[model samples]
Target chain A: MSKTVIKVENLFKEYHLGNIGYGTLREDLSTWWAKVRGKEDPNSLIGHTKTITNKILESHFLALNDVSFEIKEGEAVGIVGKNGAGKSTLLKLLSRITYPTSGSIKVRGRISSLLEVGTGFHPELTGRENIYLNGAILGMKKYEIDKKIDEIIDFSGIEKFIDTPVKRYSSGMYVRLAFAVAAHLESDILILDEVLAVGDAEFQKKCLGKMDDVTRNQGRTILFVSHNMSAVQNLCSKGILLEKGAIQTQGSIDEIFETYNLNTHHQQCIKLDERIDRTGNGQLKFTNIQLINANNQIINSVLPNEKITIRVHFRINKVININNVKINICIDNFYGARIAVISTDNDVNFTTNFNNDFISRGYIDFTFPKINIIPGNYTIVLYSTVNNELSDWIKNDALTFSINEFDYYESGKTSANGHGYIFLDYKIK
Target chain B: MDNDEKWDLIIKPAGSLNFNLKELLHYKFLMYLFVKRDFVTYYKQTILGPLWYIIQPLLTTLVFTVIFGNIAKIPTDGIPTTVFYLIGITFWGLFSESMSSTSNIFVTNAQIFGKVYFPRLTVPIARITSNYIKFFIQLVLFFGFYFYFLFFTQYMKPNLYLLFVPLICIQFSIIAFGIGIIISSLTTKYRDLQFVVTFGVQLWMYATPVIYPLSNIPSKWLWVFIINPIAYPMELLKYAFTGQGIVNFTYLGISFGTSILLLIVGLFNFNKVEKDFMDRV
Candidate 1:
């Protein structure tokens, strides 16, 4: 009878980058002592402190928070997630590259992982030698490698270049040889992380076939992670969706994939304010359901790095010459942090004639200069006042756009990082 | 497939220092391949290449003769200063090489650690073995000089105690790996210690009996030399070869016992690191 091969319970893991060079030994010892007693690390849940932009943030984020699942012998499981959704983090834990901050994982058979392409290949070694060397790294013995040497070479289809050093091989050749070695590993359970899509169409099909054989004939369990939805739905019996370090759902392949797709929609709206009542008195109301452009479209929904025009129109019923008025607009990101602001001066003192039969027909318009914000959600806020008294304030949650790709223009940027969120271009060169 | 056989390979990542020798034996071939990679890649891109293995001891011995024998006129316990320093440097370098190579095992191999899983200690264990090969190469050069001096020189003579050289080599291996594992485990989290250890070996050479004879250390602060386990082996080398220096039995026992303790503690921490060192690193 087949067995339940992989069992994982309440597995959790986290990582803090940049500031990791201290306190590792103390952490190692404490974790080691805890594991020996069959107890989880006390500090694993709290995790290490994270730092960003010279600010040490006290909030600890779980890269993989209390995730638990299992695969029966010969069962295939697929994991799907968007960026920063902890998909890779979970594979790392199951592969034992890092221990879980909490929980336990038990595998009752030999486990081999192709977590990254060419993981243990040395450039100095020959393709022939690297096949042996990498096979060893994958936990195959010299004699076991001897038996599969010809098969690995033939499957790779690079026998002509097999005697040359791997540094001389093209990237396609390198990945082919790497996948060949890992695919031939005889372990009872295999875990692959985004490695099936290697070389071209033929190579990927070959790798998929090898994985299929391992599961069907050898009764080996496979946990596969990939961005290809069709492959996940076709190859796996079970599916899991991870979102922001927590498990969103796990179920039948069709069920989890649908759930995964729905949760990954981009949220670009920045601010939640659509109406304004200044001075805490609900006296003056400004409700156009967010300021509209001349076409009456949602304003401020254009690209961040493009010139944008913001226009607001209003109506009045009082007979007054409102000559002391200014329109102020503030910008912010989706996470509720203010970035920039713009306002026209009150020097002009443009008069708005309000009479019993008067209808305000003009709109305030401002052209936003060279936009430099990255691709994310942002908000625009508008304010109107007369004679230094606040009359109306309105903030709108409009989805701001961002463009990708950096063509380096290194003529005069004081802070010339090769790539970052903002680009300061001074000249074409 | 029952629970009895499934219970094999118990990994106690924390607490005690015991290891599963049977599992290590099962993975012996993997160990051999790692050693091969280290030895080959190290000598890959050089002009003289593996010959540097023999050349290092030869060149260092000549420099020792010029500096200590010709300039400072330091006594070599009646042995040739060139031979004395060569052997001392060879043994002392073994300890330092193992320490620095393995001390950053977690940090230096973060890429491989992140991508795959093998026995975690295999790298350090392979490091010690490769250094042992280098030690053997230097030993051959030391014996070549030993034979030449005995036949040609009048002031110095070879002693029968030279047979104990193999035992001294083992002691040196134990000492090197003990210190290295401790440093390797610590440096996984505290990385700059790797830089400190690189030059730390250089500074430590001045404190050990590498360039100077053990007897030449001041009698006023004799206990200072006792902290370095290399001192006992160096003094033993002098006594066993040229029939000079004290071979204190008490000090030798302490050096041997301390090496075992350090290996245990170092392995203790190193095993804990194996679980998720790649994550933290």
Candidate 2:
């Protein structure tokens, strides 16, 4: 077995909920008085319990609680978790961006992280200058940067504008250059946090290939944190699943992802209003979502050719006037790739009558006569917008449903599984 | 892969005060690049470019000449008003600019610091080095007018005390850098310090002999000005060229001692804060 490159032991990070700076002098003096008397801090008593009542004081929260794990040399470990699950905090601790509140992490060799691209990039600097600047920030030596300057430029595919300032380059070109510089970094351990979430599909593919080469050929360890399941499965052999600031499971990528999916799927039918993981203005909220058959029977599985209607109920808490109110529903496969997007804006006859009066309660229904999706489990994302601006509700994986195999033409021939997530209509003459 | 081999790094809740010489040496190239970036990017967008470096001190000297020399009637001893004020403001500008920028290191570079890990000390060191280049330019401009005064007239005489010029420059930079990092670390939690630093540097100049001669102050109250660390270097510079200011061993010793103490405290605070500043910055 290879040597253990990283060993984390009983890490716990506590964070205050409100202001991070030193409080008023009065509070400081009181705390000092309490300390002098050998009593507990007066303010520390706040938020001691986890009940989360309206009147209760919730002063602090644990970002990472008693998390421990070890990574061996040449291992690609994927950290999977939802937001606020301590994934970034763990990475930050490992990267030395922040100190763990209580714990020790022993790491071997030099580690470099691409937590963000173009970290020190100056817009006024040319592409070549930024590459050197970013490279140095990632801990590259001047000679090393010089050695790989040509390769980095070629990899970014922006050699034509290498001398031009990055301010003039398009955002795509900018990200490409930034990623190219970071991709060329030579380190014993490379830590990445959602770097593949940017750029086009082609560049993303190139990055994945580069990552593969870096680990497989160069024999370096990797710690990857991302929500993209397929990318995690494809790149990582080991996986760690985190939940509510604790490690829930650790195993092979396939096993851990299965556990993650099972855990999330259990919460699929819960009230949308109870989910605190949503973003928006809070003026409107999604209350409930369901998929129903033509007979108005709620179903979790349906045949490929069967008609289904997705009903989304919402509640408005404020009076507002909005034109061009749009509701967008996206269907994504298990790998977190959007397979289809259906929006009310695409409907020619659709009209939103939300004028000066408040909409107390309403529901939007999207009916599909023929679900041409292949037999697979998929997730639905709900979004609302007013005047083409994002409204008070956006939910990810709001609902999950599976399409069962069926022969649309009634020829007794079923679509083959694992071919793709979408089935096309065809006829052989 | 050897079990007995030492790990490259070990992170814990509290970091040690022992300086990591190996890591700093390893990141020497990064320091060079940071200095290069600062030097290149500061003037990239400006229309006047490097010309601003010369113009800034010249203009400031003109303002000082008008206000202190013409209106306030502060004596420059035997030295010409332009040379005296130019020398004072030029060196003072170097120290003040470096101090202000260094004080903002963590807050201004939070984006880079949050994302990547390098020897955090490299940033302030690079700031000091880059500002040295700017100071060097202004120094040359000061010499340009100094030589013009020497050749075109006989009002000023160069002296052997000019040998101490290099020492004075290093002393000023060290003191500024030391105080700057200390302020930078404190500003991480007490952001109100950011507002204080700008006006503080401006007010600090009055305590130092930037606009007036050290002899102009009453002898008994000279200790008050001597308590300001910058006073020694300013007086030393004026004494070097025009031979008109105080140059004593006691004041230099005190100045040196204060600078070294401030540097130790600054580096200690900076080292402590760099590990977890992202949480609050």
Candidate 3:
């Protein structure tokens, strides 16, 4: 077996939430030291200083707590997590862009990270010059960049504009060129953070193929962090899932994915008002959401060819006259790709009666004629706008349901699982 | 202690004051590229381009000669007025540029520094390196005027003290870089210091005897010159070129020692800050 190339022990990262530069170093360090030793803070017990001490002690929260992991050489590991899950913080620590608050990480070789593409790019410089500048920033020697210049330019597919200033290139061209340079980095370990989310679908596929080649053909260890599970499942053999600054699970990619899905699925039945991860103006708020069938029966799951009705109950917290209201429910697959968007504005203005006068509290029902989604778990986003301004929005996990498999043509045949996420009508002669 | 296992790198919460010369040396090419980028982009879209380097100081020299020499009647210690002020401007210009640029290292490079990892010292060192080139250009221009007075006007007496010119330049770069990093480290927390840098250099120029001769200062107030690290080397440059200024060996020694000490403090603070500046920046 290959030796462990990376080892992290009892890592902890804590961030102060409020003002950071107010006090002297001695005061901050002493207070921090006292707290780290689990002793009463030096300022906490003083008479008439209780408020100051509370502010000092309550000002920080841990971003990562007692996290530890090890990776062997040539293992492609995927780090999966929700927002603020400490995944980016872990990547930042590994890349040495920032140091951890405590603990130690030992590594055996040079590590290159693509935290952001074209990190040091100068727009005044031509694309060729930026290549060298960016390459040098990534720890490549001049001669190394010289050797790979032609290959990088060709891979970017913008050879004709290589000598032009990058400020003149379109955003697409810029991202392509930047990713092209980063993809050619020669290092024993590569850490990536959602760098493939840019560019069009074709270029994204090309980047994925190149990354696959990097891991499989070149045998380099990779630590990838992304919300896109399908890409993670495609590239990584090992997986590590993080939740709220702690590791949820670690094992094979399939097992980890199953664990992650189960966690998201558990949140499906949660009440909308109880969901704290929502953002909107308090003028309107979604209170509850339910899925019902054609016979007016509430259901948690639906069949492939069934009529589905999504009823969204909301409350008006403040009295305000609103118009041009649009409500959209976007259904996304497990991979975070949008499958369909059902909007109230698709057919006609449904709120003509309440254009001038608004309802204080009521429910809006959206009924779909037929849902032909494939058999899999999916999530939906709840969004609404009043007069082209966002009034309420609840992103993924606003509601989640699984599609039951059924024979649409009644021939006892099921569609291939990996082909697509939707079913449409067609008949063979 | 895990003596059996050896890893290439070990990262901890706090870093040491140890200077990693090998690591800095390994990134020499990056320093070179930074210097090159600074040189190329300094005047990229301008009409005069590099010519502006010469034009800026000459204009400042002319203004100083008129105001300080002819109008204020400041003595040049028998050296020609134009050459005296030009030499002072050349030296002071480089020193101020190096100091200001060094101090702004954290604020300017915060974008790249936050995302990538390399020697943070390289950026400031590269700024000083490139500033030296601009200094060199202005030095050559000063020489052109010096030779004109020496050979054509015959009002100059030169000596072998000119050999100290390179040493003076090196000391200026070091002192500027040292002070710059210290201020850069502090400014990451207190941004008000950044506003102080520009006028601070201006005030520091007056203390260094850039526009007047050191001989004009009263003997009782000369201790400020003794402590100002740029004073001796800058005085030495004028004395070296014209052989007409004071050169005290003890004060020069003290200046050199202080510069080295300042650099150590700067490096210590800079190393401590660079590891986690992103959080604060």
Candidate 4:
């Protein structure tokens, strides 16, 4: 059995809010005076006299509270969470970038963190020189980087320009070189945070493959944080879900994702009129959205390549005596990547001089002959424009639905889930 | 001991003494790289390049010789005017430059510090090393003129006390780094120190006997200079080279003691603040 490589216990990180902390001479002097007099600190609630819960809430923000976990050697773990969910706070503490308010962390081997790429790259330095400098910053010895210089140059695929100053290289080349250096780092435990968000799609795929190779062939312990669920699923074997500074679930990747989707989308397909998280001139508003099948039946689930119609209802918030109204419904996957767009902007049935001058309430229908989406959850975002200006825009989960698996080709198997987000109708020939 | 040895690393809220000689040894290569970066980049795109290093001290010495020696008629205690001013300016340049740069270590390198982890102390160490290199170049220039005066003119003198010169240089480096890191730690929170650093170093130059002999100060005001840690090393450096200034072992011993004391306080505060500077900076 593999031994435990990382263990963290009861970690808590409390951050002081606003300018009331020790950023001035007066504050520092006051703190020193309080300590000298054996009195409670005037600026902080931590490590001092205990205060009530509400005062603590007002003065301090607990980024991570009572967090504990352990990982064994060669185990790849993915940390998943929304913004401000303490995911980054945990990573920062683990990497030793900052200290926790209370707790301890123990590690049995060397750990390298690629929290960002190209962190210390100097513009005037040549790419080769920068590689060495960046490697040193990440804790590599001189001889170690020297041994891998040629391999690093080869992996970045810009060998011809390796001697040129980094300022002369394109942004793409810069990122490629930075990522190449990080990917070649030899450590028992590697921590990465969305460093693959840059470069082109093909390069991103290459990075994912390299990460997979590291975990499988090299047997390195990896802690990866990313908003791209598909990438996380591809790289990590186990999953950790965090919500509001605490762990909500931890399990296999699939089970964690299932729990994550259910928890976040619990209020599915709510009344659009009540959504306050919207922006626009407020001339028009989206009231409801329904996904209807060919039989005119409402659906909460769908099959691949099925004929469907998305009907959107709207109400006029103000008198819109205008021309050239456009309505667009964006289809986004569960991870918030846009899969396709259904819009009235370029449809033959949409007239060029359309207007809602007198209509107080009405509905528009967009018919898709075959919606070739894969098996997963999706969110619809509604947007409308009047006279080339945004009249109303509603972001995030205007309507939520899931696609169920079906044998579209009669092959007794649906293409493996999450391999791709869309499928094309084609023949072998 | 065996239980503690099982883990390669342990992180906690508070650490002991905050000095890790072993970790500093491991990052020596990083320090070397930082020194190289500072030295090479200082003269990367200039017409004069490293020649400017030589020119800076020469120009300052010429101006001081004319202004203080010729016009103000400040006595050099029988030492030649140019040599007297040159040695003081060169030595002062090293301390002042290192102190100013090291004082800004956290504010300047916050980007790299926020993203990665290394011994933050290495930055200030590298800073002093690089400044010392520049000082060495200027020292060579001073020796050029000194040799000229020695071989061809009657204005030169040499003594066994000159051997103590290296000890004095080391003293200056330690004191500069000690005070620099202390100010850097305090500046992380109180930005008022930011404006005070450059102005204060200038005022500090007058407090020490850099431009004048220690004998020039009245006996009533001598206690003020005695309290300053840098005055001892400054006067010792002058006496070691020219043999025209006062030399007191007791004062030198006090300066050495003060430097070590300041260094301990600096390391403690710097190591404590580095872990959380990201939250404040």
**Candidate 4: where is the Cα deviation over 4 Å?**
A20-53, A267-332, A336-376, A379-429, B1-5, B14-17
Task: Put the candidates in DockQ order, highest first.
Answer: 2, 3, 4, 1
TM-score of 4: 0.82
Q: How accurate locally is residue A396 in candidate 1, as Cα lDDT from 0 to 100?
A: 35
Quote each prediction's TM-score.
0.73, 0.87, 0.87, 0.82
Q: Which stretches of candidate 1 lie over 4 Å from their true place?
A: A14-57, A264-429, B1-18, B45-47
Q: Tens digit of lDDT per residue, candidate 1, span A26-101?
A: 6558868987897755445443443242322332356887777766788888888655678887787777677666
Residue lDDT tens for model 1, B1-281: 33534622322223335565775776788788888888888799899877788898788778888988899998877777877787787777677777777777777788888788877778888888988877777778877887787678864545776787788777777767777877777666666667788778888788777777778877876776677777787778877776777788788888778878887887788877677566556
- Candidate 4, residue A387: the lDDT equals 78
True contacts kept of each: 0.51, 0.87, 0.71, 0.68
lDDT by residue for model 4 (B50-90), tens: 99999989999999899999999998887788888888899
Interface RMSD of the candidates, in order: 3.1, 1.7, 2.5, 2.7
How would you encode candidate 4's per-residue C-alpha lDDT over A312-392 as one tens digit per residue? 988876666544567899998878578988788777656643445325437888888888888888888899987777878
TM-score of chain B of each: 0.90, 0.95, 0.96, 0.95
Backbone clash numbers for all candidates listed: 7, 0, 0, 0
Higher-scoring candidate on lDDT, 2 or 3: 3
Measure candidate 1: CA RMSD. 12.4
